[model samples]
Target: MSQSTESTTESNPFTRPGFIVAAAMVVALVAVGIVIFLLPKGQSSAEPAPASSSTVTASPSASSDGGKSICGLPGSAETTLGTAPQSKWELVGRIATPTDPKTFGPGESDSSGFRTCFAHSPTGALYAAMNIVALGSSGSTDLEQKLADKLLVPGAGRDAAMRQAAADSRTTGSSTPIQVRGFLIKSYTPGEANIDLAFETDKGALGRTTLSMRWMDGDWKVKPADDGTTYMGATQIRDLSGLILWSGV
Candidate 1:
């Protein structure tokens, strides 16, 4: 009876071949779960990091000397103009007629006037201001005639008028480039304008003058002040204001 009991215990359902196979399958499933937990995340299952919400921007390209140019031509003088006028001019009442100097070219035009006279740029006006001194000092009739043409006035008394003004201002010697301190727009009309400008001479001489300008052929041209006197075609440079600190002229 004891031998029979031992045989029954050995042949129990828990020790059956089917039960052993089921236990092996359960062990394999647990091993697979552990391997899956230990494995590294890859492209197929991993998520990407959160992106930033802010955006990057670039700086502007307008330089301080961006709009400054001589005779509507790019030159070193434009950069040397100090505080005469920055790239942008201060318009008092109306918007300026000349927007871009590049379109004006180096004072060239097919209409009746000087190529330089057509320049509406502050640098162009500065060029004319400085060069006018030089021209007056030289007392060249050809230059005077050019001025008369630019002013759209009679050329008969233009030379004598310029000569007298040059003598009066003591600018008979060679005139140098003008270093403009600043400009003021006294008045403005659709086709005409008047301006006051303060400038420093090459020899540290300072002066102020009022200029009358007329707009024609898509540009501004300097005109004589309408005093209705003998000096109608003549303009004078007044004395300097104060100390000349800048030596760059």
Candidate 2:
């Protein structure tokens, strides 16, 4: 539910890409900011149950035209374009893993990029998605988004209504696309989605992490994460929001 953008030109407090620094930041936030909760096992009950990739289901309630839901939910794909709701969901917590800023290619200005998606999932529920598009070197933003759209909402790309809207949003233009690299589909049922992503800038490797999320209020939301309950939602911080200048001896 919480979608934040880590731009090449802004100072995002919740965004970074070093395993150690990210871990520290996440620990500090959860310990001080999050209220924390103990949720029932309705969606996230039996851990995570992954379904076959061949089948597509309809959402329980969808407004999309076709008979299939986006991401193969249960009903037709809903009209979640710009109308996707953003309120009500709480920013419970977040985490990130930073890495040595690595160059995307030789003589490429040594870019520095970081990846950190906010967390927002109920204690024990899972938000499910059928497909996922990891960040990669795809030059086309439209292609990137389409890859994500189809994964996020199945059948969306196949339907007429969803197709036109997405087209409109693109021809209009955008600021910059988050250089998401790896996309992995976690679950086919509701309340289950895991994102394995990395952020690479013109400088080098920023960070990487596997994020877990759930579907809430008809939208996919991220959840607090951790290698385990004891180290859940941990981040590894390499530096703060500002640039880190290295001075050669």
lDDT per residue (tens digit) for residues 1-249 in model 1: 555433422332111121011111211222223111222244242332232332212122222334332344432212222233323222211111122245323344334322354344334444343333223323233444455444433333434444433333221222222344434454554444555544443344334445555545444445543321121111122232221211122
TM-score of 2: 0.27
* Residue-by-residue lDDT tens digits, candidate 2, 1-249: 122322311222222221111312332233233323323244232321222233122234433333222223333232221111111221111111111112100111112221212212211111121111112122233533442432233332224323432443222111222232222333334345454333332232233345555454444433432211101233322322221111110
In order, candidate lDDTs are 0.33, 0.26
Estimate TM-scores for all models: 0.38, 0.27
The TM-score of candidate 1 is 0.38
Q: What value does the lDDT take at residue 76 in candidate 1?
A: 25
Worst 10 residues of 2 by lDDT: 101-110
The C-alpha RMSD in Å for every predicted model, in order, reads 40.9, 18.0
Give me the overall lDDT of model 1: 0.33
